[model samples]
Target: MTDITASPAGYDIHNPSITEADNLLGQYIPIHYHFQMLEDQARMTGFKAALNYLLADGGKVLDMGAGTGVLSFLAAQKATKVYSVERQADLVECANALLTENGCGDKVELVQGDARQYLPPEPVDVVVCEMLHSALLREKQLEVIESFKQRYREKFGGTLPIFIPNASILAVEPVSADFCFQGYHAPIAFFEDPGSLSTRYLSMGETKPYAILEYQADNAIELSFDGLLSINENGCFNALRFITKNILAMNLEQGSTIDWMNMNLILPIKHPIDAKAGDQFQVRFKYDAGGEISSLINAIEVIKA
Candidate 1:
């Protein structure tokens, strides 16, 4: 697997402050980091497939948070026109060069501005935004999209554009995590790369779906969830593993769906709780989308049952 932390500006997963800063100032993130995202084959393949499938009929498209303008380039292949909006001036310049090199300057228009404030002159057939993060936290995906949706509705009436990755499923599982590395111990929240062998899932309870976020529909800024998870094994429930599955695009005719890769988040509990087989745990958590993980940590309540 490629090293996600190879860039000079890359963040340490266990360092909350650094990670939070990166999330808040995502537009200013270094260009090398964007290159890493472009190099992700699974991410590129899934998004490319979805774009090809959706743009088959050829319609106007809006690419929000259009990093590197790659999605805009893809949409231009079939869409009549594409408005690619990116806040970072550097990325916009780079994307402009790439567009010229690819001869897509005629079909795609690159705009430098905040996605939340940008609105196309006319209604679009499709809206593509990929500002996703684990558990819908630490990223402005929900905030930016929600703002755009409201503005678009006010301007274009009830007709809404089709959103790519229309929905996301959020699930959690109780696990025992060993935060010890070479005799040093640090119980900090971290992201586990998919297919990584370092982190093991020592399950204490059955994984449960906490939320299903539909991007097209109105969603709450702050989310609160409380549920009981049945324990099926004996172990120390030291952490909660969060998984986000993005439904990029679905083809009903062929019963197929395209999805992008997201790292699994392992958040350590403030106080680890011991559990046994046939036990139950009442887990309650409240957080605002695009908020710091520390907020979630402060609001978490775990009760033994």
Candidate 2:
């Protein structure tokens, strides 16, 4: 894991005063975003698998940012009751129709309100939310989950509801990604079209895990890490690749992993480094922990070991 430190001032784009009311993505964007997310088969399948395992005993469940209520419908199979909350009214309407069509209206309750302020009649056994982005950047997943945890703790005493995707770990690695750009390398804007980012790597180095986030944890400003990378054989390293590992569920003897279709965030190093076999170098980086789409700003340093 990389050493974490306070981020420098002026990078506070992600509102620190985030609330449930903050989920105002308006009308059209919500539908489009929902469609894009649903298209990710791996992500949808992972959630389904986790929901089935967690709700096997027919407990009460809450799905935050429920989007089209797909997860809520899935949870309805095993959960005795399910509450699906979404900020957009239009989505709630669509979800309602789908619920009726799928014969799940009886098992699930649809709430058209912010998850932050919306409260269920009783405490739930599990809370599921999927508001995540690559590297945990520019998304309200952390804030939303934290708010729910605090609210649940305040109202129900020490007991905490089970959280789907108990935790996520962000990892970085040095890679030869010159094909991504012409002259100077830069961070790819996945917000536009993630398909633009390809997984072609000329050469890659060992991964260094950083920024391990427990959804219930407090907000953080920045993440910093110091490490040494050994050049096994001569190679050119030009970019830092970021990947997220999400622990969606637990208790299975075999454990579990989700192939969520998340595009890796590739940040091009200012200058490329060429090293010979057995050569080593010290790598240090600091990343802003902002929750906005443009929060991919950071500083990195590499020196001979």
Candidate 3:
């Protein structure tokens, strides 16, 4: 919980209680977000590759919740027109300055407002949003994109905008990390969990596709994993590592991996389970729809594969 009275950083971007008016004034703004985004080469390169293919013919683009206008600038290189929407005043100002510095101020239009309600002057052929987090948590990627997609359909009457990440899926794997609870740099008490420091440990197992979210799909999202994992080696499983596999663009048949596609969410299991090679276990993974930071894990039974 955050103290509402004190104005520390300015605004809580994640907290929904803050009104739109306050958000425009730069309350609780994350000062280092844009810096971090700029530093992420994998993230930037992935979008660049996607935009290079999508905007080859000089189409129009709408960058919802555009932070620092990086994606907008990338699209503006080839697109006929680009609209960058951002609600935070500080970010909007910073992005505007960056656009000018990059010599793209004339090409891209910066819009300062909530993207959900904001509409472009003309229909856009493509929409780009990079609000994704590990396991789709702490960000409104789905909600914002879904709203834009819905509003675009209603306004354009069946015309659809191309989503940057056409689809994304979540994967998980059981692992045995004995020293995961302790600090790798040094031993620290703050990093210790109640039952995480176990002496017994085992190697990790094969990963599985646990949950999936098709951003362009109209169907309700299903985020649950109930399946059996084959135990290749005898080891103690104590944690589940979640991975986000995103399809940044379609028709790219390259075998090379995207650097930004590697963000793993590691959650400790309630209890460590000992297992042997050739043994199969009924593993189940689920999390609160509202909060995906932590998840509930279950291993019903271990049987011979």
How well is each residue in 106-172 modelled by candidate 2, as lDDT tens digits? 9999987877677677889888977777777665677677777778878887677778887788887
Which candidate comes out best when scored by TM-score? Answer: 1
The TM-scores, one per candidate, come to 0.88, 0.78, 0.77
Cα-lDDT of candidate 2: 0.69
CA lDDT of every candidate: 0.80, 0.69, 0.67
Residue pairs with backbone overlap in model 2: 2-225, 3-224, 3-225, 138-291, 138-292
Greater-lDDT candidate between 1 and 3: 1
Residue-wise lDDT of candidate 3 within 102-132, one digit each (tens)?
A: 8888989998888768878889888887777
Off by over 4 Å in 2: 1-30, 180-199, 216-221, 255-261, 288-290
Tell me how many residue pairs clash in candidate 3. Answer: 4
TM-score of model 1 (CA atoms): 0.88
Ten contiguous residues with the weakest lDDT in model 3: 186-195
Question: On a 0 to 100 scale, what is the lDDT of residue 134 in model 1?
Answer: 83
Worst 10 residues of 2 by lDDT: 2-11
